[model samples]
Target: MNGFNWRTLSADELEAQYNPRKSVPDFEQHFTAWVERSASARTRLPGAYDLRYGPGPLQTYDLHKPEGSATGRPLVVLIHGGYWRGLDKNTMTFTAEPFVAAGAVVVNLNYDLCPAVTLDAIVRQMQDALVHIVAKAADWGTSAARLHVIGHSAGAHLAAMMAAAPWAGDLGARPQIASLGLISGVFELEPVLHISPNQEIRLDSAMAVRNSVTRFAPKLAGPVLVAVGDDEPQAWQAQSVDFHQACRDAGTQAHLMRVANANHFNILYALADASKPLCTALLRQCGLK
Candidate 1:
């Protein structure tokens, strides 16, 4: 190792040393551990309605209705981020509480995982769930126009894709999403493929671009806050920054912010307390604060 500066190693070599191939989000591990630790937490929220897609275990979402919340209240739909697999709706239970406290009905969604299916298929399944939610929103005490989406990591990418998806070509009805709150979001596919060598990443070249929020700006009804934790790897922050600038330049309402003293795993935790800057920022962006 003569003259081999450790810091000057190539990206691939760096990743090989830093990002182990087995290091995925581990949602299953987290979710199971959570259930075991917290015995009384129900599978779904009280009064939350369920609609199944295929033969798979009818995917569930926990809907939290704000006190005094009625049919016209704003709705924030949250998709959990566990790379592309690993997590379920339970981790997001805490995520729904604050928005509910903020007078918005909150829905934490779940879906099928990869290795069980491809990314494209999972996206479609999510879309179908959203379509059903949008249609039956009235029953859930909200409507599409009252809709907003907040996704972290993989969930953030999916939320952005929904904004860009071909509505007339597929669902016939356009989703009335009023705001987007992307936490630790990945907007570019090249980075996911080239950057962090994490096990949660497994996208083909085309899908990477196709699903990247930066590569495609969906028609957003209002401003979207792309936030990243300050302590994250440079590449993670860069992804959100590039997309935020692109959205703002395109005349779509967008801005980038830094979550102080936070990291990837717990960014959503900050979103749970109304007084926290990230939570405050999210509400301001949603026109709720």
Candidate 2:
């Protein structure tokens, strides 16, 4: 399937390949688990909540701290995925628990959804949020120089964009990103234009091309992990495989991990477990393991 164009697929085919809900029949159960676990995490974890990084109403983040002093610890930012239109940062706080327990400061970021704002605006919001987080790293008990990011689905796409962003102008200096955990991300936006979610995302061809991460050479110096669930469709899995290749072609170190016995929604369960391979790799990347 190398060099295969998703554009050639029929509308129904694109929908089947890209729409995760279609593949996961019990998707709502996963969301229920995430919300419940996230709530539990919020009650048990010690850190700040609803901290605003921008003027937008949803431009807020929850910072979960490690058990002990966080001085010099790596800061891990978590971005949730809801096809860029659903899901909230609150439901993603569960992902912060294992990272924080592993001695990394974790941040769960929230941004305005599509239709209310363009995909480009959401990307910019993530960049601004990172800048704000990096600027306030000292106050958060973490260093800006040891930042790492992990995002799921659309959030993964945004995380890649952040790694590729030129941060010198925004933060006055480029922050050293230790690693990127991109799980089930769609690096190319062209397929998104065909997906049903495009009704809300409103992505034009030009905008899609402009926002596609695969089209750009990686600017990040750190290693990247492109992960996907083994149960996902061939086209869906190909997204990560192709992006991993793109990163390697750009001379950036990248690894591809095909998660076993998992699908799109449930893959995050692996990410929330410290013992799981996905979480273990991310913790190791943060220098906590």
Candidate 3:
């Protein structure tokens, strides 16, 4: 083991080895419950509808429009992260309300999950979804120029990539994203080489290194808020820090925020309220009152 003392490691090491990349407790099941709870939230919020983001019939997204909205409202694209394999956009259905109620449109997106596809395919689908949404933004009644992306976990990772992605010249219609609200997102892919989740994500070190948000930080030049929950595992927190440092080092506007009493799952959940601190910050980022 290259004389490295894996056996003599500390308590953190013991925990890391036993629970590396292990998501916050019951995230999957809790999210499943949240998916069903969308109906309850919808009854109170209303104006929730499904829209097609891509040409494929299966490629659709949930767009949440608030009541009594104003002109040229900003859009918040909320990407739910489930290690790229699990969870649906429904787990994030309730998330758009805060943005919607804040006079911004909220788009909760769903890409093809894993076991049925590769991570590369998922990322491409995500990029295609964003472009398609922007193309439809005018018809959807929002300013396509301004977008505030809020992604949780895996969704955060994809958002980071989109934020830093090179201009795909052929897509046409340049976009203007205002800021990023990345919650508990994985920006660096290197960890997956040793992280068990890679078994399903299938990211080799080379691929992970190339696709890492940290590597493309320079391309992203917006105010980015990398938020995490204090009670979550170290790995979860590290991803935010590493990405923040990369962005900062690249002369981009980026900062880190931690929800004092929350964990991975509830950090994004708490943003459901229009008055929540995270939501308020997102409003501020989008230049809304």
Instruction: Give the best candidate by TM-score.
Output: 2
Error of 1 at 221 (Å): 2.5
User: Tens digits of per-residue lDDT for model 2 on 95-163?
Assistant: 888888878888899999999999988988998888889988888788888899999999999999887
User: Tens-digit lDDT track for model 3 on 78-160?
Assistant: 88888887777777877776667667777888887766777776777777877887877776668877788888888888888
Which stretch of 10 consecutive residues in model 1 shows the poorest summed lDDT?
Answer: 16-25
Q: Rate the local accuracy (lDDT) of all candidates.
A: 0.69, 0.87, 0.72
RMSD of each: 5.4, 1.6, 4.0
Number of the top lDDT candidate: 2
In candidate 2, how many Å is residue 237 off?
0.5
lDDT (tens digit, per residue) of candidate 1 on 137-219: 78767767878899987788788877775554576666667888889876666545554633455667887766766756765
Which sections of candidate 2 miss by over 4 Å? Answer: 166-171
Q: lDDT at 217 for candidate 1?
A: 76
Ten contiguous residues with the weakest lDDT in model 2: 165-174
The lDDT ranking, best first, is 2, 3, 1
What lDDT is reached at residue 73 by model 2?
A: 79
TM-score of 2: 0.96
- TM-score per candidate: 0.82, 0.96, 0.86
